[model samples]
Target: MSKYESVYIARQDFSTAQVEALNEKLNETLVGLGATVAKTEYWGLRSLTYRVKKNRKGHYTLFQIDADKDAIAEYERQMRFNEDVLRQMTVKVDAFEEEQSAILRNRDERGSRGPRRSGPRQ
Candidate 1:
């Protein structure tokens, strides 16, 4: 089976718990179609570059999967019909990365830098 990286943005009005439930629902959908979801990550509510579906922000989620094209097609099809899903994308990849995804890695980096200095710039 080929590998893939899938990401989706949920409508901003939803709570974190609701986003998690959506993620679980999607995961189950893939599993039902015989796909193995390797990783699931929630990036939390983030501002979009521009508005989408009348939403200024959204809850981001990522899924790394090992599955065939048909399974992914079905997955996207399901996402297309979900009103809570603002947008979704899936990309075919040669292989899956074993470490954390860049989004999460960058988030950790920013968080580990500690609080910002309040002093004025020179």
Candidate 2:
């Protein structure tokens, strides 16, 4: 199995429920293909660098997944067949990325109670 990340953009006009449905379908597809989805992050609706499908903005979502090459192929195939997905990209990760992902996941699970804190202190 290989570690990969998939980033996709959905139409900006979609409702919150629609977005969640799309996300859920994506997860199901990955799992059905024997992939383990480590995490999924919603980047929210944002302006696009260029228009896609006549839209100037889209809702971005990121997925961290581990699966074989065939799994990725199937995921891409499904995405291509889905009208809701505006754009998508899948990339393989190296050892360094795997390590970095572990660190990030640990940080997320632990919350922001570390030595450094963000924002203004009162």
Q: Would you list the C-alpha lDDT of every candidate in the order shown?
A: 0.95, 0.85
TM-score of 2: 0.77
Error of 2 at 12 (Å): 1.0
Report the number of the highest-TM-score candidate: 1
lDDT of 2 by residue, 38-82 (tens): 888776788999999999999888888999999999899989998
Q: Candidate 1's error at 69, in angstroms?
A: 0.8
Candidate 1: list runs displaced more than 4 Å.
119-122
Backbone clashes in model 1, listed as residue pairs: none
Clashes of each: 0, 0
lDDT of 1 by residue, 1-122 (tens): 89999999999999999999999999999999999999998999999999998999999999999999999999999999999999999999998889988888999999999889898999
